[model samples]
Target: MSGFPPAQIIPPQVLLGAYAQGVFPMADQGELTWFSPLMRGVIPLDEKFHVPHGLKRSLKRRPFEVKWNSNFRATMQGCADRERTWIDATILESYCLLHRLGYAHSVECHDADGLQGGLYGVALGKAFFGESMFSRKTDASKVALVALVERLREKGFLLLDTQWLTEHLQRFGGEEIPREDYQRRLKVALGKQDGTFHPPALAPGV
Candidate 1:
């Protein structure tokens, strides 16, 4: 991380600043590395948004109960539990601090198996910088994502930043924008006064 500032434990305010500037940190060799992808992945919070038919069917079946910020730390840990991950101890601790400040939130999907899947992210103004997600049961994470988008849309959010493009994200109309274009969009999103990661209530029980 020669070109970047040295990794000190990131304070919540600084973390929010980084997100507002269109960058985020992931641990590399136990040190935080800041990333600003040249092509940024973002899901449109507009008419372009679409849920796949299969996922819609799953949604209809109501396989998981959706909740927001009810288990933030646990959701972060779940996302970090896979064989390889960027959500190291420092990253986890940093985000937990943000959650306490109301700038970070998790959307969770729970079934009889406990927390089946979920995702976490940082919110600034009208932008949601989606950090990571995980699923222990089939389609659990997807369900959580749908719930999240609905909440964001209902709250008049303008941006859903995914950081990088992936096939999984593409199914929901996620697209890559040039860094400059993303920055422009980010600027507009951050200019808005109201944005929130917390949903008004836990989603209806599955």
Candidate 2:
């Protein structure tokens, strides 16, 4: 039986344009695809959702530290570490390129040991397009997210776009809104960017 060829490489310019237009690329199997979902998932920083009791307890127990943009490449690699991940080598390289262009970001959660859980994504205007997150310990990622949202809100960011919603996200008040509504929110968020946030100061372990 015959097999597939390979996924087409998305031009960097095209990727940037797509993001600017509220659309993005995806790949189902072997094809590079673009999509603008009608129903968008987002977490409003002002209306921050509740932290689960178990996670809250976890946070208090471990007291993990939060870091921002400390290791962009490391965070991306960690998130893409899983065996069945959608983030291939090409996509990883693309994310790194975006970081170099001042469009990508990474939020790290760790402790006195080393890296634990965290997230990474694109930062355009006032919107934080969260791409993916990984958790090596419970509530570690949650603390990182809480700190990120606080910092964003403090620094005047307007939107936290998670792209698609999940049960895990629901705890953080992630909600689905109509495409038009989302676009409207995006407009406001993008318009309210301040472009400044404090960097993390955590050491290799702490």
Candidate 3:
């Protein structure tokens, strides 16, 4: 797919505008490409939200200490440490800038060793565009996700846009809606944005 030329400098607000328009960026061979999928994947925060029995059990075990925005750079690095990733130096630097501006945030899971798993994304209005997640310990990322959803629900967020669905996300009831429908939802969500990613009280388990 073709994309707009990468700007000489990508300001954090520019990135936020892209997400507000329902598009996001990916890096390939040092160039940035934008995407707005025809079939968009999202995790509904409504009554249909489901958690697997195994993960629910893990939550009670309290395997990881969940933290928010404490180590945004480290969480992004962990997601990029994999063998194949779209998060290049350019993307990394830009997102770090966004985080500094409080428009991008990370939900991190840690054990005694330090950060074990986490995810990061951009928050605009009432929507969270989940970017990536990684785990060094079993259920570490899952626990982070649980905490993320609970927080979103508490904050009155209306949407959690995952961009795409995977087997990993499917277990949490990820579903795809047509672009038109997603755009409608996006419009409503953007209007409702409160300019905050501040999470509310976490669930009792963790």
Instruction: For candidate 1, write residues 95-122 as lDDT tens digits.
Output: 8888777778899999887999999998
Error of 3 at 112 (Å): 0.6
What TM-score does structure 2 among the candidates reach?
Answer: 0.81
Of candidates 2 and 1, the better by TM-score: 1
Model 3: which ten-residue window has the lowest total lDDT? Answer: 197-206
Residue-pair clashes per candidate: 0, 0, 1
lDDT (Cα, tens digit) per residue for candidate 2, span 46-129: 866667788777767767778877888888888878877767655677778777666777789878888888988777667777
- The TM-score obtained by model 1 is 0.89
What does candidate 3's lDDT look like per residue over 33-138, in tens digits? 8899999999989877789999989899898889888889999999999888888877888898887766778899988999999999987778889999999999
- lDDT for model 3 comes to 0.83
Candidates in order have lDDT scores of 0.83, 0.72, 0.83
TM-score of each: 0.89, 0.81, 0.89
How many Å off is the CA of 153 in candidate 3?
Answer: 0.6
